[model samples]
Target: MRATTTPALFTRPRNVAASVAAAALALTLVPGSASAQQADTEPVDVRLKVADAAPVEVATTPQAWPGELLEAYGVSVDGNDLVDVVRDGDEVSGERKRLRQGDVVRLTDVVKERKTKRERVRRGTVEVFTTELKPGVRKVVREGRPGTRVVVARKTFHNGEPVKYRVIKRKLVKDPRPRRVLVGREAYAVAGANGLNWGALANCESGGNPDAVNPAGYYGLYQFDLGTWRSVGGSGLPTSASAGEQTYRAKLLYKQRGRSPWPTCGRLL
Candidate 1:
């Protein structure tokens, strides 16, 4: 014998709500199968009461489901289906939503869904940078390697579709080391111990003017002082000396001190 339940809950299909209607065939509520009954202690109890008509008998049972929930919708459940539940209701491309064995026909109190994404920021960490030292190198200095900033974006979704989006916020993710450049600044060789290239030395001293004389009594292409010129075996003013004599004396000075005598300017030589 089929059992009857009242005050059932109705469910609308995912897409349509008002499309349900009376069927051409009589929908008879049948008793559940033994398996359905075993799955539920209550058994698959389903019974239908039609207005001005006697209750009818159908076959099979609802698969591990509650059939009483269909009552309030005026749907007569014969097993898992209702009579006249066909595929000719809502039109799309000249076709209606087709009904299959396990289709949900109706729904109530359902909420529509839309997808969206939001962005957020998180704090970043600072890092250290080191420069290697090489031979003839003096000391390594550290100035602190402050990091830089980066921009990022995030997207959210609703109902498997994008609805709303924005550049919600900024985030810091990396701390870079301070700016560092490897440099060389020290000279280990004895000043001027290496022979000087005098041609370059003359250009720096006086633009190679053999008659060049400074206001301070320094005279000649080599900018020789009076005493220094005589010490180098040159008599009289160096400007009065021949270019050959002046060059000879300059060579002597280079041999003695390498180039310490012309420190800053000798580097070109």
Candidate 2:
């Protein structure tokens, strides 16, 4: 016998049958499968069939601020709304009033009027009266009587006759005349230094009566009230004695106090 070498071969029976079935199926289905794959892989012109949706509606409203704002400055308002007051009441255009919390709503104009001063009137009065006098006649009197051989009395008159004559003279003449006068002569005099106009002051004070005295005991051309006179260095001089002096003193005071002396002096200063 010749020496023979043989190669050993091993095969799984289940795998072999599967492989044969796979080969048969591949041979039979490969063309159809390839065409199906090609159809799936190829890009197609796709179109989405989406229906038109109704337009979504959004609710919208205007926003408003809570309260009105006032823009006016330094003006008082009298109405509920500041703008109305400034526009209508004040008649100011482009200047509407701005209102704020705790604000007082009243408007007014501050006006100062010139002061009116009444002239001081120096008061004075005059009095006159008549009285009957007896027991005296024209430098002669009857002594004894006509029955006792009668001493001749000069200028002939009967004895024991009632005479309608009386001594007519003033016993006491007080400030016997009412004169229009100023109340503050000294004050006026002092005012003279301050360019006080005496022309008008005298017209109002005493009408230029140096002897004028008021019912209130004010005396002199300036008609110084008793209290005022005493205060202004008045020496209680009779109105006649101290008119000039009082005026001088008053002018000095005017210079000191810067007050309108003419008012006190009835414009005399």
Candidate 3:
């Protein structure tokens, strides 16, 4: 009588499912739970400083720069491509910056151009007075004689390569105008060869014309052949000069060649 048999009742699978459904329904019925979940799922926006630097000051106007910068950065904004990264000294500040989404970087370099000097000579006829004996040695005559004269003149030439780009294919095509630079003076300075004698030698070689290019492709006031020019350390010399500069280099070369570097003008040196 004290140990009565207890009946074990089996719960139907449908009844278990109903309990779980009731629990889910109770959770949905909780106040502000759905709103709390939404708040937890929302994304947050954050501000990040670049290079750990303070904010930079930016200019209201745009500036101009070389196209090479565009090639290095390969950058674009909105729908327009950048030709250069020009910052106005007065308008831009170290604190200046812009909003960007993709990979961005800054690069800088100094560009140099090859300079060539050329001279053109002209032939003309002129009247000359001379004493000449016509077989009998009895007559002085004035005659028009043909003569070839070399008037060394200078013209500067420059050529530039297009900026290399991999991302975009847009560029500004321009007709390059040769800029005339008086390099004869400065070229002689860097020539660092013979002071005034170098100038004299150059005058003899290239007529003190910075743009004087010989038929053999020799260039500069110092009638330097491509090989010889490079041999005598012409690699570092400026491509132009004035009379004073030409003389300066000429003297330096004279010292290097030691009174006989230039057989033709060594004495002058």
Candidate 4:
């Protein structure tokens, strides 16, 4: 029998595939490897500001949406709230942009409030023409009173600061009272009567008595009848008018009828 001793056969382990995979993973984790470089690019640090609150530092991955980042930080947003990106102390763009290192995300709270207030309405002046005084003379008969109005407005605010205001409705609470004034319409100077002796005529007509009255329905210093008084632009009873007013109407009458209206008191001037 051949004492043939077979040489010892060396066989590879069945775990060769596992060992190769482990070696490949180790190479990828080494410095400057593709996996190591990819890890370094993640976990970006950014600043987040919400309304008037203080800014906070947050960590996120590159190219991550700002909405997702906010969700991760447990922040909420409303439909009216404003979101924006800031860089170098200036706004960059909308909030839908991806996250970047050293970027700031700002959230502004928008609010609208309805307000009601009362305001004053200024009064106006009204003029009433009369012949009680000389022309160009004015007298206040009634004082004016201001009115009130209710105003309803919508005020908009951003982060507790007022931004816009608009008036939505207005209602008059009280009507304004107009000021009433009496203005004179008699001419300052009556033609052809300036050189005449008005005092003599008045004394001869009613003895210079402004309140004089006659049984023939004549009254005042000029003894004017109601028909003649109104023809000379006189208002109310001539006896109720002032002495100067009575004289003015008499002068106007003289300019028209040449003292013919005062038949008994004629030729006194």
Candidate 5:
């Protein structure tokens, strides 16, 4: 036989099992492999609540940010709106946090508005006593006038509902005018006339004017004529005498004639 050397081409590996194991480990350590990528971006389930609306479930990656998730979910947020995140029953900063499984995202809409309104100020009453008319008589000297004011306020709304209101400014537009009333305190000693409604009689005769004078010779608060005034012991003209004296004389006349001196106004007494 000729001395021929066989080639090592058909030689078998000494550690074939170890070589297969090393190859499998190298495949698992690859950075761009499907298993590695899937592990890095695992899907997470989260809940999103926006401005009084019902909560909705969303599926996102664990590394996703709050704003990015909202944008992907078609949720728009304004500049004044607020966003909060809750995880494991505790609240966290939405801006600095990433989405996690079982996480809750809350969105609140905030709005501020300025309003103005006109308000009315009620007027007061002032009473003045005078002896120019009989007791218990009243006269309106000046009518009351209400004032006006403008109020400015700031209203805050959360989730389209009013939350707080604060007054910013107040301006007085007009001052209120008080009502002036004149009351009577005159006294009389007539038996049946002192207790009569002399005020109504005066108002019916002379419109409650103490210096009233009629063209038919009637004068004073009671509109007494010259003859009737003298019969009641009145010396000067009824219009020239004081209001107290005129009332006294009218009472005396009423006691004598029993309201027959003035036919038209006697019904009032």
Candidate 6:
């Protein structure tokens, strides 16, 4: 026999009342099914915990429930992008959300970055300055070797597509080998005279006439024969050269073989 008693479950929540007893709990627990249908629970209040941590201050204190800066802008927190938990790279529908410190922002839109690497650079030429050769004359006495260097380049991409490449940094890995060059310069003069009177010798030889020639066919102020003049780096006849050149040759000749070449005139000097 079914009991004819009315069970009161109006004071409790629907879920709590459901577990009370299968014999009495329903949309309403009135005496008749007709009375239960007319009397129904409407606009009931329920509480649920959402995922993601909120401010510890809000949970511990009697403060207003989860609120954000967006509340001043009149926005609701129900699945709103602003109030939801956001990571560094977490995005929704191709739109970016707020990022936390630990979030890694993955930029899939346009990736433009510079990656530097060490590579074998082509050999380079080194310039070695030399005083052994003349100013404008260049001569490489030693061969040069190529050197290595470091080059940095940047790669640009757009929408996961490659666009361009450019060099960003350049550094020398190995220094270039230098070439040795020989150059020419003016010869240094001998410091002091060796007690020989060049003026006296010239005066005695041809009366100081650098262009003088003897009747015997000997040439110059110092009376140089072909054989002797050629030995002292004098081309052609000594008389054909300038006074300074003739004197210089005579001085050189004197240094080598002494006054013996002059003979009679040598005694006068």
lDDT of 2: 0.34
lDDT of 1: 0.46
Estimate the lDDT of model 5.
0.72
Steric clash pairs (candidate 6): 88-103, 123-147, 132-183, 132-184, 133-182, 133-183, 133-184, 134-184, 149-173
> Would you list the clashing residue pairs of candidate 4?
none
Instruction: Mark the regions of model 2 whose C-alpha exceeds 4 Å error after superposition.
Output: 1-194, 238-240, 256-269
Candidate 5 global TM-score: 0.46
Runs off by more than 4 Å, candidate 1: 1-196
What local distance difference test score does each model get? 0.46, 0.34, 0.34, 0.71, 0.72, 0.50
RMSD over all Cα atoms, model 6: 25.4
**Per model, how many backbone clashes are there?**
18, 32, 34, 0, 0, 9
- Give the alpha carbon lDDT tens digit for every residue of 31-134 in model 2: 33222334434321111100111211111111100111101011122232122222233433232333322222222212222222223233333222112222
lDDT tens readout by residue for model 1, 165-215: 555445454554444344442222223423456677788898999999999
Off by over 4 Å in 5: 1-39, 63-65, 88-90, 93-98, 128-138, 183-269
Candidate with better TM-score, 4 vs 6: 4
| Cα TM-score of candidate 1 | 0.27
The TM-score obtained by model 6 is 0.30
Worst 10 residues of 5 by lDDT: 1-10
Output the lDDT of residue 34, model 1: 34
Name the lDDT value of residue 117 in candidate 5. 98
Off by over 4 Å in 4: 1-41, 94-96, 135-137, 185-269
lDDT of 6 by residue, 7-27 (tens): 432112222223223322232
